[model samples]
Target: MPSLVTPVLPSGRLNASAQPALPIDGDLLLRPWLASDAAAVARVFEDPTIQHWHLRKADSEDEARAWIEQWRRGWESETACHWAVADVGDDRVLGRVSLQSIIMVGGQAEISYWTTPESRGKGVCSRAVARVARWALEEVGFHRLELGHSTANVASCRIAEKTGFALEGIRRRALLHTDGWHDMYLHARLHEV
Candidate 1:
């Protein structure tokens, strides 16, 4: 039996011999970031609503380009996969769903995502997340996918609920915001595939 007081480890660590592969779904192909995506990424970050839901640097076109470069590097290094959620039939970038800060601790991977103003309430991000979650579980071999969000982000909470992530609990004052430290809701979805 386990004690309820024992805390779970963050998913950034894993023991030897428990290798988990990251998944790539060409069917849900991510187009390479373009120079044009700079403007789009900038627009996404301009949405104060979106920023309130994420932790990001001060916004600028140059920063957006730099962000894309880092995104490319992550892919090249096999560190993580980031998919630009676009208009589905066009090159216009709407937002992004990314496997950010992947921590393989204790046989799990912590996942995170975001969406732009134009794409909100349209289900683009949720569908993208579901596709990625399926791939992460069935293809990546990660035993768990962890999602964390501030309690104030109702939209993201909805996304987690819609995607079948169970609300585990809260990490009190886990993030530093513009005003002060904020509470974070920890959500988890064990590999069901």
Candidate 2:
């Protein structure tokens, strides 16, 4: 019989300091979310797509600020990390990318993201996702990164594929949306040694 063992974190573990601003091409930058970005973040949540997929709604700037605060806590606790995807020229926030459900001992985490309505169809999410995945696998030393999206979300499917995540199959009734139970498509990318 073979013994099953999980990978453990190295000496100091992952860094939870200031989130790095990852540049994607010349148009997009993934930087840490700011307290001043509350208004913009609130606006992004106004889109029906984001509201539907994410379930909860941030109707006010205060709610959005709380969301940012939560992400900051996640970083400080070394449990998750999030970045705001911004336009390089003007520094306008375009979207968000987060590495959630982190398990340092297992060398794995789940990725989630959403783009403002204006930023859609511009490859912002795809580029940001790819950049973050690279950082997670190489710099952070995570062996695997997972992403899940509602089966009906074609855009998410395209983004996952563009970022090199292989389709791992579906989880029936995995999520509950306002409409009802929805199936989710699971995808993952593994770091090659």
Strongest candidate by lDDT:
2
- In candidate 1, position 134 carries an lDDT of 81
lDDT of 2 at 64: 93
Instruction: Residues 102-186, candidate 2: write the lDDT tens digits.
Output: 9877888999999999889988889899999999998778989999999999999999999999999999999999999999999
lDDT, candidate 1, 1-193, per-residue tens: 7545422333232222232232233323345566568878887777888666667753789888888888766555445556676664455676676665654433365677777676679777777788778866766566688889889888889999999889999999999887688899999888764
**TM-scores across all candidates?**
0.78, 0.93
Model 2 residue 160 CA deviation in Å: 0.9
> What's the alpha carbon RMSD for model 2?
2.7
Runs of candidate 1 exceeding 4 Å displacement: 1-32, 104-107
C-alpha displacement of 183 in model 2, angstroms?
0.7
What Cα-based lDDT does every candidate model obtain? Answer: 0.69, 0.89
